[model samples]
Target: MMKNRRFSIFIVIILCMVSFSDLKAQAPANDKASVKTFVQHFYDWYNVLQADDDFTRKHHLSPFAFAIKERGNYFDKPLRQAISDYFHKPLKSGETGLDFDPIAAAQDTRSGFQTGNVKQVGNTFRINLHDLPKGKSEKEILAAETFLVVVAVKVGKDWKLANFIYPAKGNMSQTDLIKLLAHQKKFGY
Candidate 1:
């Protein structure tokens, strides 16, 4: 009963959310320098995925990786499954799972960081994200979305997801709703 146009848009939106997730993940490097490094590293990882990343490489995520998702049920997995499932393929060690074009990706990254927040609490790192609603009231409700994450300590100088929660509508998955889409060719729905 659903049209392909709707299906395509759904897929695009999910992928964009996954990309945003990547852009937002970080462990917070001690000081301002460390914070910048942490954010830049994650940015690079996202860039690779945007590029030709055929398989997903392992990530040293913060301990509070999915804290927001867990508390709010926005996502159930350690990270967003929409992103994880797409990169389920195996990748060579030391290779980037995702890569982005340097020039354009840099510009986008710069703009994105201009409006974001990252905080640390002992071993866990928390994140809060908000964006302008676009040509409207500055005092009015802006993006009005926030997230809380609690990251865990990893091996020396590293960290991975411990728990995270994100307030999300948790939209019905397009992958499950649609039938006969190329991705579901095997089931032949």
Candidate 2:
């Protein structure tokens, strides 16, 4: 009787361990889906603001205005602080601090955008944002311009924007939000 009881207990313990191991293995997949969803929601909100004539006309706000206003909801502390400081700082004579929208990576907003491949490395995620051309099929979005790459990191219970990776433009090399902010200050731009 005693032997049987001990064996039963051992089997239960083994089963519990296996269950937990499986959950651990699946955590990354679940997290990846979550990260992808979070980015999609952000772009959805951003694009709506961009297309809203009343919102833009009434407030005279840029598309990034929402992100800046509710930064704490979208950005982690480090990234939030960097962007806030850069925008709020007074410019020197002849200094034009970032002329383009860093998040959109363009001077003019497109009619729409689509989220593309989302790749995760460790806790960081690189989510592709592609410009969706008018009258184009969903298949064509893959070939469309990759305007921005959002870098997101898990912050506490939620994912937060860490940086933005913009593609190379004419005369301007590929750059990120952190690097651009630092460069502007370093070169007195």
Candidate 3:
């Protein structure tokens, strides 16, 4: 039984990989552009959170909503405002701030999805993130490691970060949660 379950997971991952491979060829340029766009959009929305009337509207965050918890800080906010605030603030070069560099990114055609895996031993850290010097020790690996999955439907020529969340696993990771909330925006579920 255990072997079966593991096999099932393996199959799922294989399928996901196959999906990504197909996209790799056709999507090399297209998906790469989307991935780059998502990063720049997210970076500006987060690291360069300076108030800009142009970006404020360009972000189209008013329609989106995002919420994720880190340490004790609740990361949920109106999509536009949340990303706006993120870009509005300035972070020091090596500081453990909201914005962190992505180690690698891939575009999956089968799923029409763009995903990126952030390494665990990179310049930034996202451990429990409260105690700092002491807190840094525990989740040192987890801190720097997280994943961002994005869903985009082409608009004109560029792809925008419709919605994104952190490393995935259970509810704690919050990717599915964001998707759920994204769906319930109108009905108020």
lDDT of 1 by residue, 1-189 (tens): 469889999999999999888665544455434443453344344334334333223433321232222332323244445334434545555655334222122212222211135566654454433322223343332345432222333435644333333334368322221121223223321
Candidate 3 lDDT over 32-92, as tens digits, reads 5444445434433332322333533765542122212111121223444444444455655
Give RMSD (Å) of candidate 2 vs. truth: 7.4
**TM-score winner:** 2
TM-score of each: 0.29, 0.76, 0.31
lDDT, residue 24, model 3: 48
Q: Write the per-residue lDDT of candidate 2 for residues 17-136, one digit (tens) a residue.
A: 999887654436677778878987887777777777586667776667656886567887887877777877789999988888777777777667677778876568888888884456
Worst 10 residues of 2 by lDDT: 22-31
- lDDT score at residue 179, model 1, on the 0-100 scale: 23
172: Cα error in model 3, Å: 2.7
- List lDDT for all candidates, in order: 0.37, 0.78, 0.36
lDDT agreement of model 1 with the native: 0.37
How many steric overlaps are in each model, in order? Answer: 25, 0, 12
Indicate whether candidate 1 or candidate 3 has the larger lDDT.
1
